[model samples]
Target: MVLPTRQNVEKVLEHFNRKDGVIVVKGKELRERDDTDVEVDFRQESSFYYLTGVAEPGFYVVIDVATKRIQLFAPPVNPDDVVWMGYPDSLETLQTKYDVDEALYTTDLDARLKEASAVYTIPHFNLTFKDEAIKSASTEDNDALYAAISEARIVKADWEIEVMRKANKISSDAHVKVMEAAKTGINEAELYAIFLNESNRNGAFFQSYMPIFGAGMNAATLHYNKNNATIENATDMILVDAGCEYNYYASDITRTFPVGGKFTEEAATIYSIVLDMQKACFAELKAGAKWEDIHTVALEVAAEGLIKTGIIVGEKQELLDKDVVAAFFPHGIGHMIGIDVHDVPKYCTSVERIDRPSYRYLRMRRTLAAGNVVTVEPGIYFCEFMIDPVVKAEETKKYINVDILNKYKSVGGVRIEDNLVVTEDGYVNLTTAPKEIAEIEALMAEASSKKRKLE
Candidate 1:
């Protein structure tokens, strides 16, 4: 399908507000693995795809700033190489297939570049070919072009939003597959394979990022990917933070549940706290909403829950003021989600970030707007690495109940994440995975019953 990318060009032009130069960026080219000829997977640069909807390799896009006309340049087909690689689309076909005003071969690109008033590109974006005009045009104009494209990408068009929603649905179903198949003695590798198979069979061959399949104490480490351990204990929890890319759009959803079908009491308490954190953040998400405030809401919920569990004893405000809650919930709540999992331009030079403990790691500091898509992920970890600092601190030492913390250490970590599209009134949650305590238990139980019947 031809994406409405010509309108995207117009949006960038509107943001750039410059008519003196031409915008240029190159698409990614096929590359080999080390010395071998085997092709590494190719993904078009997100910024380039935003301008011209072409996903193929060895192409470049140039847009005239004054006239707002788009020109796409393709690699010249080689007859000898075509014997093995097959012929690519003809220039005429490319012009008709993509949303560009003109399509030409790379042979004609340098001449056109020489003829332009000046060229502007995303700063430091490597061109496929060398040209005197391109080198001369590298200046702050390139930075300006980068900013223009990022600004345009922040708000999704209706079609982009739909693609992202489909991505979320596809990945959400994959999460259910993982949840249903999880059991004691199951290898994390097997669960990882199950998720990949489910997503691939549904036509999503590319994962948004490396899949995390941490179980038991492994879950305490955020961004864990050594999914090689066995689920040795029935009392343990599994945290799967994975998603597949549907047509270049991304879905990032994280779910934590019992390794066995049912959560133990201690695991249930921690899981509920993380779920509550996500819900509280969801309540504060909408157009004109402050992103830092949403993050703070997650922190507040985490503080209250930890206190209720008796792991930390102190007033809520004091716990937050002393940064005690951040020890358990170390990461930011979430960030903008789109083409890349952690989408660009979330922080601009105009927006200064909060320097406090809770705000240091936040990926975004801008005001939320309608048509923006983001993830609301909140987590609480029983990780010693995070808690040791708080325990050692003189001022924060009084709040912790060491015996209580040790009791829940076996619970590891719990996190819940969902993709949502911000609207004027509120947000639309695209994730379909079962997250409520009873809902997750019922789903897993049903799967176990089916397995028994098959046996």
Candidate 2:
């Protein structure tokens, strides 16, 4: 990790090694809920962690471009602090631990900045330290630095890939646990708890995001997190979009499974379409592949599936051109995943987001490159909010099979999400949860047999 952090810093220096400027980045401080005694756990900012791999707060890094020296500034620990927060590492220990050229007390930061002609920081979402003494100092714009770092982070380092693989494994196993625990009578909250407990037991520090354990109609609402519904219909499906963070690297996966261990006819039909769409997208993932084109492929495949299933009637291309696919599959195909779930360098020199309906929400619009990890999640939802207005509109209602669509009004949605890393030849899927319909049914049936014996 130390070597990788050093390499990452060197990458940053490649673009900003000027004679007079110093690059400054601030780590996150411990934060508390507004006016409350409860304190949120401290996690170092992503950029700070990328450069220094230091997790503690009240720390900052200064990279001098002239000498190419890296200095780490940390807050001095007091005796009173030690009493409450345990023993603190000495300056020499931290210096050696982080492999920095020099480690000094943060109080000396102002004096150090005076030696440099300009101070530069990363763009938005950065912690900027303010000192009245440095008000007169010239501040360098950080656009170039931000773009450089973001580009560098687009393709992950070897160490990052390793951490992400582990995170995905933990998340994958957790999803399996939830699938086994799911049943017609279980509340969504109970399934959520099962996922959390499994992830924690498998060594996840925290969830990358709030778990989405939507049952029945709730599943149609993307990003649903209320998770309080009781799954009364044995035939309804459960969509669990959840993942955990391991060592600050994130893994995102979503699995939709039937509550009764076997998918109902309506649920199975939608699931097959979504699963096929995911496979089509996966086949197109490789180095230099255009992301927007991949999304277009997803739309074409989904539209074709909808047409085959009698939900929509039209030529595939015409349906896509008319934006009819957006009714069933509203969101983009997927997004990049790394320290941040939606990783940076979304648009680069060769690629930018397209303004079309499906491509607009696409998080990563750049061409694919080896070492880039992304999620291939394509869904087919039956949400009334997204479909009703379009169906009622006189212009777009002709393509919709209203009778067939009404039959699935209660079907909710089906999303098959998996994390994958782009390679020279193709992509390697990181998610290992059971996705095949037969596989899911068999796993749940085995769990039920064990439960019956226990009872």
Candidate 3:
């Protein structure tokens, strides 16, 4: 069910019709994720899928503003299609299901455009369609339709938020499965498979993105997607950061846990610090709060925590002022999550400059507003490149706790992430997964006991 309801399509059609030009939404096929495979997944385009409920690829819908009529362009299924990819759900069913005006074959799109005032298609990737429309019509109104739809998706509606909540719930549950399935002698990919299976079980229609299933120092790498490493219960820690997308809405989550069913004191200390920092960030997540404000506070908390653990010495303010904390917490606190994981419509915006040190790197810099969803993820990673330069730097040498830091070089990293939605008063956390050490240990223990009984 890729197409939205008739009312939803009307909402978009009305928005387009109100303008001078007509809106032409072209549906595209989803290519395989792998670089080697060009096979189509037959999933509908996200924006088009949002407006219309049709999921099959190679379809287009046009709303004529001047005449106020809607038309769908798709290939009529034939015996050949049945012989290849199997029988497609009938186009008549799709039309009635989505409640659109009319359905026609692909051959009619050009003729319809010639009769319409202006053809408004999506931007960037719609190059082929855009060129075709331009060639077919000499009318000046045939222009880009990207801005309006992009603007519409910027502030989420309540329904979109609900869908994201569902995705987040499924993703969080998958993380729990990984926590229970991880054990000594198992490969990281095998442990990650638990998450994949659970996500599929929970109706995760598609993975929001590639799952990051890294263990030990691999966790230190920010975007570690390779799950080939082994999970040794002795000293390794596993970081599973992943999510599932439902109805084009995405959820981003990260939870790090000990591989041996219990966190070592070393891992616990770092984990607790990151956890507390995330909590502090949540406290400041009310409407109108700047993300940079939350990020600044999290860094201060991380610096203070590190001082207490002897990872760094000297006044917290002094260390933070010198930007020493940036060495450990490199990335932004979080980003906007929706149809795309990084859901900012204008990926490259000339927005107001934030006062943060690395303002450009901050993905989501807008102030928290009502109906806007974001993530609060604070992490402390011991990356070799980040820490090594600081330890050997002449200016930062005084603040370095080389002896204590060297003791746990393999302790890896700690990250705790949860999806949040800003409300009128404070905020709502969409993630509903187990995070406490006790809860994770109990689940793993129960699974192991069950395995023993089965044996």
Candidate 4:
């Protein structure tokens, strides 16, 4: 699986050379859940993985600036440990596998730091050796080191993009499988289980984040993950915002569909509008485009659609100027997606997040560039909490059509999200799940037909 090559380590070391410092990075360790004896499956920390690409716990990497040398310190295993956890690779095996200059036992890490003049390490809550290493040398916070890595990560290398493409393909296929199996009486948890099963069967070791399997009113909650509600086919819509990790890269996708295999009149109208809004945003994405501008375009498109459907009554431009669209689309349009789901933010040096209502929630505000991977998601929700309080306010009341809005208050929401990579001219969509209305209906119909034949 695509381990970071020597060239990747050299890139970070070059940044460290500017300050004449050495870098000390700690890998993640296996830990037990809260109070349980069971240990959670181990995953390498993202920053550490980006440099070393070693997945095992209890390891550290040191890159020396002056000498341009890299070394790995790994935990040594004894016969008893091997009896419990099976055979462990030798230091020579690790050095060859990870393509490092040398590998030594982690017990030597403390002594190794004594030779460094300046040291830098990324702050991590669970880091085992950060404090000790700092005390042993003239260490600093190293905000520059963090920024350097983050900036480098903004534009993915060809190999990184390839891994993300595979991740998106696996996630998209799993989403389709869940859509075909979804029905009226199934519990939200069952659908989540189906997604997990399919992802695991296809070789995804972990989900990028907790799956959002909301049905009906539950869909209105942005980060909902209870996944315990019953899906009412006659009235409810299923919104699954889930993705899987492949080779340390992440894919995030969201698809909203009718549980009854057909959208009701009101549901159809709202779904189509949300879909169009996403399309408008996609058209605006390209190298050199500001993320804020793309978001503003999405807001305009959604506002016009809401006005056409009688949900809001006002001039489209006036509604946008008043920031009234924030009530329906409360969150940012999307964010960068890669090693971390909400990948590194557009650092303050690039652009500070705007303070205005609709712009405040944006996660990335920098100009787009080629080789950058991002998710473009635009949605509209009838969230009672976010809408009702504003609706009660006298000054904001005139823009709403209360009668028409009430009809959809129970409709929950509609969101369509896809992963894409910026190209020289536009963007290439990595997600290939069927999104057209006819395509969704036909696939569900085929599944139903097969079920009937089996019975």
Evaluate all candidate structures by whole-model CA lDDT and list the values in order: 0.89, 0.85, 0.76, 0.84
Off by over 4 Å in 4: 14-19, 34-36, 125-141, 346-350
**Candidate 1 wrongly placed segments (more than 4 Å):** 126-135
- Per-residue alpha-carbon lDDT of candidate 3 for residues 351-405, written as tens digits (9 for 90 to 100): 6655544344567566677877888888988898988887888998788788888
**C-alpha displacement of 404 in model 1, angstroms?**
0.6
Residue-level lDDT tens digits of model 1 in 17-99: 67676778889998989999899999999988888888899999989889888999999998986998899999999999999
For candidate 1, give the lDDT of residue 105: 95
Give the top-scoring candidate (TM-score): 1
Better of 2 and 3 by TM-score: 2
**Pairs of residues at least 3 apart in sequence or in different chains that clash in candidate 4:** none
Q: Count clashes in each candidate, considering only residues at least 3 apart in sequence or on different chains.
A: 0, 0, 6, 0
User: Which TM-score value belongs to model 3?
Assistant: 0.87
Worst 10 residues of 4 by lDDT: 131-140
Scored by lDDT, the top model is 1
How does model 4 fare in lDDT? 0.84
TM-score of each: 0.98, 0.95, 0.87, 0.94
> Candidate 4 on 1-455: residue-level lDDT in tens?
43665667676665553545567888888798998968899889888888888888888998887776889999878688688789888988888889688999988887787667666777443334454444333224566677767776767888888899999999999999888988889999999999899889889979999999999989999999999998866568888999999988999999998887788889888888889989998898999998889999889988998999898988998888887888999889899988999887544565677887778998878889998899998999999888876678787789888999999877798889999999989999999998888899888889878878999
In model 2, what are the clashing residue pairs, if there are any?
none
What is the Cα root-mean-square deviation between model 2 and the actual structure? 2.1
